[model samples]
Target: MNQLLWMAVGAGAVLSIEGLYWLYWRYVGSGSVRDYINEDQEPEGDYRILRKIKTPNQRIALVEYRGQMWIYGNGDVMFSTTEDENMYAEAMVHIPMAAAGKRNKVLIIGGGGGVTTREALRYSEVEEITAVDVDDVMLEFGKHLEAMVRFNRGSLNHPKVRTVIEDGRTFIENTPMKWDVIVIDVPEPTGRYPRLSRLFSVEFYRLLKERLEPEGAINIACSTSFWMPEYFWSIQETLKKAGFQVLPFHHFVPEDGEDWAFCLATTSPVDTDGLRMLVSTEYLTPERLKDMFYMPFYFANGQNQGDIQTDDNTVLLDIVSEADYEQDGNRKEYN
Candidate 1:
């Protein structure tokens, strides 16, 4: 009987080890399901390849991962359909438009899918919108994808919307004219690409600050509240150090299973009151604006909680460490 009990204990230990190995391989080692799939060869509607298109410049794919449409360019998944893409586009574009008080001559830095351009045109007061996106294939795929096209119907073909195929950083550096409103809709910095990392740097925000009109606002998609607290704070701090009054806001995206944050920094305060006045088709009301500022204790406490910022160094790394601790604690409790 003792021999049998010992044998059972040994088998249980082996099974436990195997279970841990599988969990690690599934979550961290293999990366997310959205990241691993090669959209080029994946057949459409096969629980993969939501849609695929190849343009002259690059290959783009749209896949339904995590219950939202994700745009992949040159094998890199760019923006996902977070929140209602329409609601997000409307809030980002219209808030700044109303704040600017003049809609003519706008510059959209990264809205390749044309959602922002569509919302910008809704006012009818805006004369021209120059949209600069690095991925040309994304535009092509979006045009062909019925649901995507429907999101911004007729806006891509609108006479006022001129699509400029170029890098956003290069466009900003070389463009001669100043913009009334500059909507920066770039992806979060994952350290995957050096150019993406540069967007979060102090120098880059300074360049963006220089290009803006005295009252013009820059709206950037910040990182998720869950995965990267350090990244979000670093971005906010970098913008603040670059000399803009920063206002941070978040919107919940059910499909992404995360609350996405956005930072609006400008020489002038963003007209939250003016934004409240807009005839919103969605639910971005004054109360909602207030709610966006409310962060949970875990996220709020993790911000500068256990970090020391010196003159020579930034607290980005420390903030990330605290966030990780909180995330792991929550995971353990739930599991």
Candidate 2:
């Protein structure tokens, strides 16, 4: 009788926990969870979960939301969406690619989804492209998973592309090989991300400069310019302190309905005034590309408000601890 009572208590606890989860799921938006749980929930309206993967480094999910498929990292980090990925990808990849005159041997750091690689492959001059990510599983998904394969268009498996599973900063530090263009398509260091925050430091960019060819350039995805103005400027300032000529620009992602900014950094002299695309683009033309440099009125004014980000003094990490991004009454939710 006692044993039966204990079993009943355990079962009750389980049921109660599940009930709470159900309530949270019902109330909140699609989760950005750290736990390895594939939420294969039933299709609610236009939202459905397609896949979930657990890597030693990160939790990944592929969900179909609002007639578009989206990939989320750690439940919150929306890596890419089928909706306007091309617009963001083109803006991220093309500027730096155009800056690099040789356009051969490009290195894409942290874009395991392969969207950036897909854009880089557009240039016929690209002889060898290396795509590196910390999560090997995500790269496998991009290379093999049917939905990801379709989305990335098998760019990971191209003969000209080589996939490496490694930390982006470590790879840059160790490799003797120099690249014509290096695309930093990693997540923004907005939260308490120790590892990721390190990547934004002056130290990392200086090391990256060493790996870049004299005529080469790099493009880093500096989170939303409007939402986190200070952080955005900090990244640009950080790059400048690292001894690179920084050209800050932004483009809108329709799915998120927010302005995502990017920076083109190079030690080489860049003629930002006469920038043009060497390859044809689906979304970004040369005219639009040049115009991206025009900053929002308020955002332009705060360009000098940033402190240089460093490994020891992580201003970028400290500025984004949930409370800072609380605009109006809406809580900060990157997903």
TM-score of each: 0.71, 0.83
Candidate 1 lDDT trough over 10 residues, lowest sum: 305-314
- Expressed as tens digits, the lDDT of each residue in 1-335 for candidate 2 is 99999999999999999988876765554543334222422234656667777666666777777756566665454455454677878888988988886798899988788888988998888899999998887787779877778878899999999999998988888889999999998776644345788789999999999999988999998776365667777888899899998888888656556787888899867887778888888777667776688887645634277888887886877666543446535754331
Q: After superposition, which runs of candidate 2 have C-alpha atoms over 4 Å from their true positions?
A: 1-21, 24-46, 190-192, 253-256, 301-303, 322-325, 328-335
Compared with the true structure, what per-residue lDDT tens digits does model 1 show for residues 1-335? 99999999999999999999887764456533334343332324635555556565445667775556677754554555554566677667765666664667788887778788877877766888888887776665445556667667756668888888887878877876787788888754332333455555676678888888777877777656555555666677778778888777777766646576777777877655446535555756678766766665434534432322232443554444455466646632210
Which pairs clash inside model 1?
none
Candidate closest to the true structure, highest lDDT: 2
Report, for every candidate in turn, its global Cα lDDT versus the true structure: 0.65, 0.77
State the TM-score for model 2: 0.83
